[model samples]
Target: MSANCSWRSSCGRAVWRSSRSSSCSSRRPGAARPGRTDLASVPNGQAPVLPRTTRLFQGRVHAASITHIKPPSVRAAVPRRPAPEPEPSGAEPPLVATDRLRKTYRSGDLETEALRGVDLAIRQGERVAIMGPSGCGKTTLLNCLSGLEDPTSGTVRIQGTDLYALGDRERTRFRARMMGFVFQSFNLLPVLTAAENVELPLLVTGVRSRSAREQALEALRLVGLSERAEHTPAELSGGEQQRVAIARSLVHDPPIVWADEPTGNLDSENSQDIMALIERLNAETQKTFVIVTHDPDIAGRCHRTIRMASGQVVPEPVTPRAKGRARAAEAKR
Candidate 1:
């Protein structure tokens, strides 16, 4: 061994390691060996330090990191932009609203105005019935309000959101998130089980399959159809299928439910039972309901009746039946 036990700048070790020898193999694999070392100057040599932004040839030369740090003066001179304030949504009612809503259908220039400048507002938690004759555009109004179809003109606002202003995909997502529909036809798939049919909306909204199935069962229980959860739509009766549709609507727990002749296909007994179920749900969930129907008894059950004529909301005529029902409702209140 050499008597000069010099400290190498590369290894920073007092024991000398020759560049060509493998005997001192204590260093990392593939590391570059020290070419040369000075015995006399290493014991007293000062650490090499470059400027703040530049490093020396080897990390051991300075044994310090190189980085750019903003000075306190520069940090103090810069100003941050203020965050914007959110707009107030309290100006309008948090319910369904429409202003001068119009819908015109054109079948090769044979134009038909389905909704003629209709303006109405349905308050939150109100069960509203729209009664009209055939071809009076009651279903059209429901479609436009629920984003199932776009109107030719005017604005429809639901929960302070401009329904038509959103893109097709965004409006679909918003409708799925905010509104539920109970169609005149049960609209249940023939092959899927009751629970599977009810859980479609939850699955569409990206919920887990297990959680969606559990929620679907709970909704079915709410509608008194938990016993038929595994049965197909064909296996159930008409009333039971309608009850499953109601379960599907409530599975999402939407704030608004648009029902288009929900009991149109059922008999009088079934119709009464269905309407009773609807009233119970409305009372329990406090959900806003807009039902389009031709039955006076169903209309009598609502908070108010909106009569339509020729695609327009006409004045609600106070028939003797309506007067008696109104007085009864007042008595209950």
Candidate 2:
């Protein structure tokens, strides 16, 4: 029996020879000592057995974890939308009101109601004509609207500012700054030249003479009378004088132009010419016009016509000319 054998390998089983003397007491046949392999064989016929295998040299095993992550990608910044477009500079504002504007006149004991609650609105750049027979308040309405006469009742406004609230001096200044007048009669001065007649309004406003003359010439040029600038109104024809009058009205570049029978005294040929000129100015310059006339032909030429009868505005059917003009404009569009 080898007592000092190392327990190194799996086969390091203890081997023991039975004691040489059978009398050697208490000795097992294959019993191993402590810190050594078990080699004991039972005397009651027990056989040697091996111990079971276990995880002695193996390292610890951990559960695997799974996590989700997103990858980076290319992105662009979105552009902001542009703001909505603004209204045009010379455009008319929408109608705010059409009130009962009236007027009354008393001649000694006889009373005349020139207007019976006339409800109307004159927007910026609106071309409107006042048409009717005599005593229809056409001129009276024009006078009130142009701030030349005060209304008996009701109100009139320009861009929401009441015209009647202004004092006489203030009203005069306002008229010079905001209105242009064209009378039925050729109101030109016989003494002043065409340019000088055109410069009257500016002169009244106290503009410098040189500047007034310059503006007057330009206005005459617009009416195609630049060649006749030095000629007096008496020297010019009826049409030319009317053009000079128009030039005078335009000298101040007022927003509104009030024509009280501008062509009432002119023949048809000259009347057509004047209407054509007015139409051109309305289309090109976008100036507001309120023309008074007794001619349906003249009224037809305007964008809108309000017919008056016995001091009251009466509704009328649209003329063929207006229909034709509307259709032509549509076709052009």
Candidate 3:
């Protein structure tokens, strides 16, 4: 038997035969060739021929069947999300709002409640006056609302911003940007001239020196103190000094102006003049004004008056326009 026999039996067993014959005599009638299981049976006289598709490797026939498999697609279809709709702009927020504001001052067991749950709202471009007797919490309410002092509890929202939510330094900077304050003492530096005093706020807020000077001069002129710009506080009269203070308060053109006892140190005539100036400014600039005063005459000029007593606001008649008219009539008498 030759070792190069390429014949296989029906049970997949090798059949040895002579290599020159090209056929195996030991192959049975139903025998299947090696790696060619698809071949049909032949007659006893006819020899089975191997398929031509089979390849010869190392003197052995091999039949290979290949099946191609495709991978899953890398790109997938995704659904897109829709965008959010914007809110309507018709409804405007209040310029200032306070909710249940409370302030307590404690000094070594002496507890003083300055504000007892004050809830207030002031609209934009409105002139509001706060009036009450001494120690009635008017000043405390002003201080708390202006971010000058923190409330014991409750929220102060100025132009939709929570004032106490910010740190001390940030609150100071925000207050400087959004508010102008006027005090009864005219809080001007004595050494600085009128223009310099008015320019102080601008300088504090990082305005350029030249622009600050120009703005200071414009504010002084608005307050009718253009001629007194070079004069020191000592050289000006009491009314002129107050005018300078007004100029200083308005030099930055803040949205809100807070005046604490603005007419307290002035006489009746000077008080009337100062109140008129404030009214004019409020009308011209459309700025919100919150003034704390004891003078009924001064309070009458405001658009609305809020009266307080014992750390709470008292119910009052809404006769702001009538009060102004009455005061004007009384002045003529």
TM-score of each: 0.69, 0.69, 0.69
lDDT of 3 by residue, 21-131 (tens): 334445568774332422234433343443323346787755434332121222345888888887777656899999999999999989999999999899788789999
Q: What ranges in model 3 sit over 4 Å off?
A: 1-91, 318-333
Candidate closer to the true structure by lDDT (higher is better), 1 or 2: 1
Against the correct fold, how does model 2 do in TM-score? 0.69
Tens-place lDDT digits, model 1, residues 78-119 = 587898887776644759889999999999969999999999
Q: Which stretches of candidate 1 lie over 4 Å from their true place?
A: 1-94, 319-333
Residue 122 of model 1, lDDT score: 89
10 residues in a row with least lDDT, candidate 2 = 65-74
Model 3 TM-score, all chains together = 0.69
Candidate 1's displacement at residue 49, Å, is 98
Q: Check candidate 3 and list the clashing pairs.
A: none
How does residue 315 of candidate 2 score in lDDT? 84
User: What root-mean-square deviation over C-alphas does model 1 reach?
Assistant: 18.9
